[model samples]
Target: MSQAGAKRKLQLSELEELRNDAYASARIYKARTKVFHDKHIVRKSIEPGNKVWLFNSKLKLFPGKLRSRWNSPYQVQTVTPHGAITIFDPKKGKTLQVNGQRLKQYIKDSVPTEGVESVTLADPIYST
Candidate 1:
């Protein structure tokens, strides 16, 4: 009977040890995932007077597959401390504040064409 009690105690201790190890492994896995998620997060910055496009996430009943989800470019008026931006609409003359994550810098298509290099050929010498 004493031998049986000893064996049971040993089994209980091993079970406790396994439970502790499992908890530790879970903690380590959670920390690793947090680090990975933080690493992949993108940081965006906007300055005053910068034009940016806003993401429109409003759901429609019939969503178009090829339609662009971004809105027109808005001029930035000010940047708040907690990722909030105050933007101005030039056409409507209205201003509003929104999260910076919804905004991306606007790139215009009209690039300067004045500095293109041109090739010039010298006039051929007159034949005698």
Candidate 2:
């Protein structure tokens, strides 16, 4: 009976050791994954007077895949050291503070030319 009890204690100790090893392995895996994810992150350079688009992440009910999720042409007002950004909405005539991660640079399209050229088609006669 004493020998059987000793064997049971040994088995419990081995099980505890296996659990500790699994926890250590999980920690190492998480650390490596975090390093890999942070390395691939692209940092955006945002400054005052730059135009930016705001990501509309609040639409949870009816999220349309074809519709654009970004709201555009918000002029940058100020940038805080902690990634907080202030943008001016010209149409709303107000300024709003948002996170830098939700903002992207907005590039304006080129202006269309006013000059128009008219093309006339000539009738072609085919003889059999």
Candidate 3:
């Protein structure tokens, strides 16, 4: 006897079980994240008091005014082992905390030399 045109593929439930097993067998695991606001350099170590500026993502800086942009400058107040960074804002003279993924270090070229860059954050405390 010969078995021809048999359905060989696993069912959806079987596939799901295999997928779960994959998740369980993995010794080390991390989430897959996309690099958008800032470049993510692998194997790079970040220390405290390293001095980083937050990139303002909502405001685009003009001659005398700040336009729509994203990310803002925030100093690194603290860095946890899990990569959580506590940032301090000089504009409001307050301190806030955020995750590493939520923040992007401000490059010198991104900021204007003359006058204040102009802080246009929606809230004093950064929510990330």
Q: What is candidate 3's TM-score against the reference?
A: 0.40
Supply every candidate's count of residue pairs whose N, Cα or C atoms clash at under 3 angstroms.
0, 0, 19
Query: What's the CA RMSD for each of the models?
Result: 7.8, 4.8, 15.1
Q: Rank all candidate structures by their TM-score, best first, as comma-separated numbers.
A: 2, 1, 3
Question: Global lDDT for candidate 2?
Answer: 0.92
The pairs that clash in candidate 2 are: none
lDDT of 3 by residue, 1-128 (tens): 12332333346567889989898666333233333324565433545665565545334445335443444566677888877788777778888776676565555676567876677868587689
> Candidate 3: lDDT over CA atoms?
0.61
Q: Give per-model TM-scores.
A: 0.60, 0.67, 0.40
Can you give the lDDT of residue 57 in candidate 1?
A: 79
lDDT per residue as tens, model 2, 1-128: 99999999999999999999999999999999999999998789999999999999986568787888888689999999989999999999999999999999998777665775767788987999
Per-residue C-alpha lDDT of model 1 across residues 1-128, encoded as one tens digit per residue: 99999999999999999999999999999999999998997888689999999888783555599778788999999998889999999989999899998899998989778998887898878988
> Where in model 1 is the C-alpha error above 4 Å?
1-20, 59-61, 111-128
Give the runs in model 3 whose Cα sits over 4 Å from its true position: 1-45, 53-68, 110-128
Model 1 backbone overlap count: 0
Give the residue spans of candidate 2 off by over 4 A: 58-68, 110-128
